[model samples]
Target chain A: MTQTDLAAFLAHSVELESEARERYLELADAMRAHHNTEVADFFMRMAHESGLHLEEVAQIAAENALPDLKPWEFDWPGEESPETASYEAIHYRLSLRQAIQLALENELAAQAFYASFAQSSADATTAELAAQFAHEESQHAAQLSVMLKELPPDDAHHREDDDDPHMPE
Target chain B: MNDVITFKAKDYKSGVKPIWCPGCGHFSVFNAVTKAMAGLGMNKDDTVLVSGIGCSSRLPAYVDSYGFHGVHGRGLAIAQGLKVARPELTVIAMGGDGDGFSIGGNHFMHACRRNVDITYVVMDNEVYGMTKGQASPTTPMDWDHSKLTPHGPGVRPFKPAALALAAGAPWIARAYSGNPNQMAHLLAQAIEFPGFSFLHVLSQCITFCPQQTDWKAIVNERQDAALEDEDEAARLFLHEDGFQTGLLYQRQRPTWPPEAAPPNDPDLTGGFRL
Candidate 1:
């Protein structure tokens, strides 16, 4: 990998963190709309943590002029960036524990992504940076796991029943 | 790249959380629309989105731009009027399959024939998700889950792309929500085209039609290249399955509000005074 490759890799890293933040914010909004304030607040906190990660990535990016790439140009192992949460996995009645679990899964995926990149990169600097990023993602995942354990056991049947359904009367 | 103002996809969002169900395909479409708008370097103030009643109609609220969440099935009519009144604005009309093909079916046809310089994006989820799991105009003949249609709708589904082609729309295309980047590219191209453009998006309703989650496996890129000839387009549309996604037809045509007349002209109504 060359300087250009490193810049591209950093750009992707920045995007992954940014997307994760955005996705969490969107989930928080969705939860609020569903009148689930408890879960919404939890999601908001997760989003704030993701924002801190984004700032760190931005600080690194400030050290180098990252290449501007289109949303489609990034070569992710999956259909989208590794840390971006799946939109389909959200439910209006989702529990706080479930939300944290989802974030934990995304953090683990991000960790795995960086680990693979570090192993595959031939350039020493790129490999070292990837390893460092992987370590940071592992820490985030560990923190989320601890947060999940602190939450009360989720009751699968604790969903609020709508008095007036949206179905045709 | 000199003087090019770059924008990220998130910059186009309104920051208002979408209330759409988790796993809903509309989320991808929303993301794609914003990406397309940003890719075009469109001025948020100069762009407007209009939509009728449906789950997909909520798209305008999520996009940070001028929008109108109009009455049920009248999104196209409102969009056309706005486009005519303010031709400089980039007007886009969006709704679900039921809103466009059933209640607002007539407006859909005329909007295409009128050739207004507006883009219409119909998120076809087959079933009416907003009103629970009811069969919509695009629902398959064999979909028999609805109590109202215990034996299924038993009618042929509406073919949106072919109908748009027949109705004189100059640009017609289909995209899948499963591939947001490709959808964004298609949307950008549709917006740039100088005629009435119909973008049919195969967005799935995960709650009502959970089986459609397999669309990621079923949808395929169009093997045949985009057709510039009307006859060739018609042949391709008629023969191919609806799962093929890409620009199917495009042709240069005269748009509405033909060159404006000089402002100094005498009032034509003066001669007709009674």
Candidate 2:
């Protein structure tokens, strides 16, 4: 699909960030449903952080017209937000460190997606904007790595609960 | 800025979030469906998805399109009727292996034979995930995981793709939730197809069927490029040892729509009853 006008692209970036934030919040809710309080709290923290990033993206709009993209209109290669996809692949019994690993993987993928756009684009302005987005994603990856490093060591024997009610007995 | 306000896939999702178990594969199927719809630039108002009773049947509630959560095993019948009446609209039917094959088994066969212009997405988790857990039609024989069927349902399991093909379905394919991009592409193609299209998605029911979580690894081992020839596709589909993933067959067939006769009763007036 052709990229929309500059202002719309900017708005789309903001929406993309917002989607990330919303996805984090949804993950938090899912963790709570599974009664994984620690994981839920971690996702909530990530949601708050995403919310702050979304605010920064919104600031870039500055009265520019943001194109309206329907849920199906975004040119994302994946189905949903990067964070959402990573979160869906996680289990309820994951530790904080494992959650952080999942988050880091997503951040790296997001960074790569933006970097690809930045490096492949022929338009100077588009490439510049993509580069800026890539840098932002890089910072997220670094931050997640630091958080992961601060976690306590985990026992190799620690395994998740095998009997989920949803599973057939 | 002058462009009309476009909605993203997120916008199409309903406020009522999915109650499906976290890590369930249906979420991926849902994501693929919405993504395919978004890729097509379909008007939400112009689209309708109907589903029967089951865990996978809840798909309609998650999307913002016109939806009908019909009774158990009756989704195809309702969706077909709706499409025949409103040929201008895009219609889709969704359900699980049990709902589509067990209770609604008869409808499943005829819908393919009728050749209605609609898409049917069956989230085949093999074992029924809803109502706790039960042996489904697609559950393998001699693989008993359920307390209800202590030694498995020894009868041979139903193979959806083969049945669809044998039943004369014009479009038949198998997809795995682990490969969302390819599944989304198949869904898009199925939606655009002229006659009955069956998309069998191997979704994991993480809560009830933990074994399915490894389906990604299993599915990764099987990938065939889309085939353009029917004879070649038939050979690949008919001779396969089961467990392949790709568009198995696609054939052009005349779509059956509702008769164009006008309403004749006086009760067909434009006014509504007070």
Best by DockQ: 1
lDDT, residue A146, candidate 2: 92
Candidate 2 Cα errors over 4 Å, as ranges: A1-19, A51-84, A115-131, A154-169, B1-5, B220-232, B241-243, B257-274
Model 1, position B18: C-alpha lDDT score: 82
Off by over 4 Å in 1: A1-4, A35-42, A93-101, A120-123, A142-169, B1-7, B260-274
Please give the clash total of every predicted structure, in order. Answer: 1, 18
**Cα deviation of B183, candidate 2, in Å:** 2.6
- Pairs that clash in candidate 1: A88-B23
For every candidate in turn, the CA RMSD to the true structure comes to: 3.8, 5.6
> Candidate 2: DockQ?
0.30
lDDT of each residue in B163-272, candidate 1, tens digit only? 88889999999998877778888999899899899999999876777688778788998767788998888887887779899888888799987977665648877657
